[model samples]
Target: MQPYGDVDSTLRAIAGRAEGFGRHAIGGLHGALYLVTSLSDDGPGSLREGCRRQEPLWIVFEVSGTIHLSSYLSVSSNKTVDGRGQRVKLTGKGLRLKECENIIICNLEFEGGRGHDVDGIQIKPNSRNIWIDRCSLRDYDDGLIDITRQSTDITVSRCYFAQHDKTMLIGADPTHVGDRCIRVTIHHCFFDGTNQRQPRLRFGKVHLYNNYTRNWKVYAICASVEAQIYSQCNIYEAGDKKKAYEFYTEKAADKEEAKSGIIISEGDMLLNGAQPCLLTEYKESVFHPSEYYSTWTMEPATHSLREVIQLCTGWQSLCRPVDNMVMN
Candidate 1:
């Protein structure tokens, strides 16, 4: 059979087999499967079937144009979505996985959704061992990447986020909560919240490293009572001078509740002259220490403040400071 013919046949076979409940295995030679297009008229059975597989599977989408999904893409464990060339524009919720394990999403673009709480990607429940790599997301109301509840062992790398209300949001699932402590690794991502939406975050043992952010007066990074946050190598620049005050420290709790918990470490963070990035108590922990009650200059190594403001304000109105006071 011809190459296209074989691909078509394999996809059809997988789809037909996956529709049923019992375990089904389809085998093809190493080079037999190639160049599957999700935007084809048949509705992306090649990719979807790979997602439904119970065993290890590698599915590649050559995004010639855009692939729109009516609902969310629920990918289970042992599955991979690789956008070879195509830009997968998820007009709806994009990708949502609940209670799944060991799934991977890579090399895709997620457009904003119309729904109230639309997110680029959402991992929930006991879902663990997930990786989101080299993805671009924009214009979502809630956040670009969201990991919640007991979801653990997630690694997000080399992703670009901008033109959204909120770039990244992490939290514990309020329902069916667990104490396992979601451990996530975020590295080398770009966050720009130019639209001024609030950034929301509450996660356990999260590592935020080497990220560049802009204009996010609401929050460059936020941690809730449920989070043991660790951060380094991040750069955040404030948009408005007054809004910088909101971007600085733990807000919305009693003095004792806010202090003595979160561990925020060294980073090249930029702030407007009006807002200081340190609290009175945590001044000793700053990587580049600043004097108390003194105005400091922000370095240009950070991203543009306007873009970050849009991302923090336009994406999702979730993580805002409860009080307007800056401790320092």
Candidate 2:
């Protein structure tokens, strides 16, 4: 394992240079990083210290080995963690960020710690503008990802998950007033499963599109609330023989009322057993429905011109080295 001082100094130096250049976005109070050596060492300790300093911090694991957490890593708004790829891994029950906004977590591997309530990632209670990309979370007792209670403007893309109790869970806490739910987008992800989940969804607007699933699982997607959750071009290979999609709601209403619980906009999807099958979720629902026994395919591709331009213009510019190139 790399010594914590080496990593911490490098990050601090970057923050310092960014400050000297007057790039507030790259520095200022939001630029500090928190280095957590091991999950067993003291994660909340690092987080508490960062909070005390009142800076935007990044939590990194020094040990490349697996480190499990007793509870979730409670993150504040506008903070991010860069796993530096899979060099370091956090094996935990899960991560829970409550009432936080503008959180970005990328390039890490998560092993869901043991417990019924364990989930790979859980965003809760008015969290908004959260982005999770290019991560792998697996071996959990519950769903890999779960969102609840008025959390809005969240996106999870380009992630890999397998051997999960259930893949995705979206809904409202029901007990909380003034905490209803709204928009969430999930796309370009992979799920490998063969079992069904309980209480799939309760309330919210969700978009499930172009996701690839395997193992002939019990379900691909579902809903059970008041919203428009749609699935477009999703590929599934459910082990079952039924080609028809399943829509389950506690209350069966007329067409319009039925739409309130779990709504499906587009259901016809093709699958070919590939990876990262271009999924998209453009709407919302609690008890949404999904197709089964489908397959999809995916592979890494070189960048296109438009993609390169967008990448350069966005956050890429901030992380690029002084030499004007992204380091591998």
Candidate 3:
């Protein structure tokens, strides 16, 4: 409770504990700190071996380089991959967490992930109680982050997602009704110049709060397949195209009677764009503009989102500073 009272306190707590900040709900993650001393694919000091071990570990990097993973790095449960105090860039296949629990990934950079299933981080089915914080992801072949197959109780905060066509996907497929179990919290992230899907959800409950969005080529936040999204106190600055929010169904057309995908917006500020067109429950597939759902109302943000997000979002300065900070 010491850190949960305010924004500064919360950030300080997250920095002090790294990925261990949210470990209490899953019975607390206690592990050894495994230092990554090599950039090799596999060895004693390599990240591959560190994550491949069966026990819980806090994987910290000592060296700085780009690690091109030959295959997806399967991480076990109760693990924390902390990339602070080093410049660690991951390319190639990236990371995959399947059926794991109580995982933490923070302060890393992922780019140039190509080939099949080249996501920056893919959380597969039945994984729960995961935290991804303060990482930078871009230019992946598939998606920056994919949470699918009923992954739940996940928090993605203070991360930067940029320069990718497909950014984040919550549900695996439109017809995977099991995805209704997904519950994710995305807060204090920066979606900069992303094409679309930041993220596109399906059959899930996603809470997006206090994030910054700029120059989105396609629609910013999307909901499909009966996904319910609660967006609060976010800043959206659209460039020359697209609105801030959109609703669509995979199997149903815009004119169809299917009423899927719901968005509840509160205290959000949209700039350089028109008001978002909300969906209606009428015959022409258009919802009334003033339609309101009385589920919840977010309290006003205590601090300036633009000011606080700039310091918190993205990979904070490594041991040495990197010039990858993009400011709009």
Candidate 4:
């Protein structure tokens, strides 16, 4: 089986269909193609130059290797960095998505990043309509992916997270009341032995479904400061640590007192004597993802979920022929 689908459906995987909150992300489907022929940090025909371009582009790789970034590569609006064919590993610094929209990132590998606060993908400051799918994220200085500073309408699906501290953060901090606008969907992901924060959310409405989280060091998921999370049909297995879900109390910019967030769970399988710590009393309401959109696929969190996650999540080698040529 491939990451997106089975091997037979690999031909149809190029359709930029993002489920859940980011369903409107077109992601350069109507834009021109820009082939990445070089593996340099920044130059002509390089990935960095194509990302820096102002116009909409569907960037694909022609070669297979590591791209050591010197700094965070600033990506523009309406872009799709599709690494379906090539085995592209990004190290050093990572990609920064700041104040941009309609982006899709697929099938890339994010490994050892050495610098401070260097995430695999940093989406911040009002960026929206993003879909990060089928990517492999591992060690970094900070997080694998962070959606903060009011960035909203994102969907992260079928991705693999491993060997990292603070794997993902949905809302930035308690300092930003603007984070109240954040809405994200995380589905069909495999969090394999990651340290913490499968996502630590603050003031965001997050939907987590059909994922397998195993062997985490600190905690599997967190909600802080007015966040609302709906976890459905996910399998959470523990190693040594036991808190599958954790909450932190923090005073936000607009709060009266310190408050940990709320979580509403449905059909979640917590194994190996895991604890769901301090379940919140969401007396008002919680955001249900099905109320907004319902095209997403899911199954029950059975023992078969472990096998499915191990086989289907992460980068897959599914290459198809391309024709258009629009260079930078």
Off by over 4 Å in 2: 1-29, 43-54, 60-62, 173-180, 197-199, 241-244, 251-260, 265-268, 271-328
Model 2 earns a TM-score of 0.66
lDDT of 3 by residue, 1-328 (tens): 0112331232123322322213332211355667899998888899989888878666778898899988899888877787777878999878898988877787899989999778999999899888887899999999999999988878787889988998999998765778888877777788989989988998887877778887888788998877778777788878987488888866433234554588877678887763664643322332222232222223354446666676667787745222232323
lDDT tens digits by residue: candidate 2, 216-304: 45555555544345555455554552322344554323233433344453543433432222223433323342231122222222223
Candidate 3 segments exceeding 4 Å error = 1-28, 251-258, 277-304, 318-328
Model 4: per-residue Cα lDDT over 246-299, one tens digit each: 889999987689988888877899999778645646634777777889667777
Compute the lDDT of residue 176 as modeled in candidate 3.
Answer: 77
lDDT of each: 0.51, 0.50, 0.74, 0.86
Q: Assess every candidate by TM-score.
A: 0.66, 0.66, 0.82, 0.93
Each model's backbone clash number: 28, 38, 2, 0
Give per-model CA RMSD.
Answer: 14.7, 10.4, 7.7, 2.6
Candidate 1 Cα outliers beyond 4 Å, as residue runs = 1-35, 40-46, 173-180, 194-199, 241-263, 271-276, 279-328
Candidate with better lDDT, 2 vs 4? 4
**Residue 105 displacement in candidate 3 (angstroms):** 0.4
Say which candidate scores most in TM-score: 4
